[model samples]
Target: EPEVTQTPSHQVTQMGQEVILRCVPISNHLYFYWYRQILGQKVEFLVSFYNNEISEKSEIFDDQFSVERPDGSNFTLKIRSTKLEDSAMYFCASTKTGNIGYTFGSGTRLTVV
Candidate 1:
């Protein structure tokens, strides 16, 4: 089965630093979404991307956060000025179509101090 792959399984950074989390969605998938889960909290949607554009975003995806597919392949989430509260496990998910089941990357655990 195809799977989404995220780099740097874990990361630790100082407050106010910048972080770029990378992800490669399933090759055949057409829709992609970024989500985050605080240590013990429920998953929270951040943004959705399709057709090389961001289709929707949650309030949590404020100016500090941005998503982009720089090339035809990988997707990336950049978090500027990271804060302690921003520490969480970021996941990348992809679906062949909106109706199909999603394949999610294990996630990148970010720790902000």
Candidate 2:
């Protein structure tokens, strides 16, 4: 089975720095998304994408965050300015349809210090 791939499995950046988390979801999937899990907290939805546009986003995905599917293959989440509270395990997920059979990337761990 194909898998969603994330780069730089772990990253540590100082507060205020910019960071871009990258992901490559299964090629045939139609929906892609991002979510984060703070060290001890449940997963928090960040954003969702479809047809080259942001289909939906949560409050946490504020001005400081952005997502793009550059080149139609690379899905990326950019944090314009890092904050201590932004530290978390960021996951990438995709599905052929929006409602079922989701496949998730291992995750990129962000550590904002």
Candidate 3:
């Protein structure tokens, strides 16, 4: 079975630098989402994309963040400027429909130093 893939399982970046987390969603999946877990906090939704447009985005998805489908199978989330608070486990997920549970990647662990 196909699975979502994320790179650099752990990332340590400076507070002012930029970081791009990469993901390859499951093949044949049409909906993609990005979520984050701040250490012990609950999972929070960042953004969701479909049909080449953002379907929804939470307040956390500010100007510093952007997402793209760089190619047929790759999705990316770029943080233009990092902050200490931005450190978290960022997970990429995809599902064929909203009614079903999502399949999440192992997660990219971002650490702002």
Q: Can you give the TM-score per candidate against the true fold? A: 0.97, 0.98, 0.97
Q: Candidate 1 — worst ten consecutive residues by lDDT sum? A: 94-103
Name the top lDDT candidate: 2
Best by TM-score: 2
Alpha-carbon lDDT of model 3: 0.94
lDDT per residue (tens digit) for residues 44-84 in model 3: 99999998878999999999999999788999999999999
Error of 2 at 57 (Å): 0.6
Give Cα distance to truth, residue 45, candidate 3, Å: 0.4
Local accuracy by lDDT, each model: 0.93, 0.96, 0.94
For candidate 2, write residues 1-113 as lDDT tens digits.
89999988999999999999999999999899999999999999999999999999999999999999998788999999999999999999999989699899999999999
TM-score of 2: 0.98
Every model's Cα RMSD, please?
0.8, 0.6, 0.9
lDDT at 16, model 2: 100
Q: Would you give me the overall lDDT of model 2? A: 0.96
Query: Which portions of model 1 show Cα errors greater than 4 Å?
Result: none
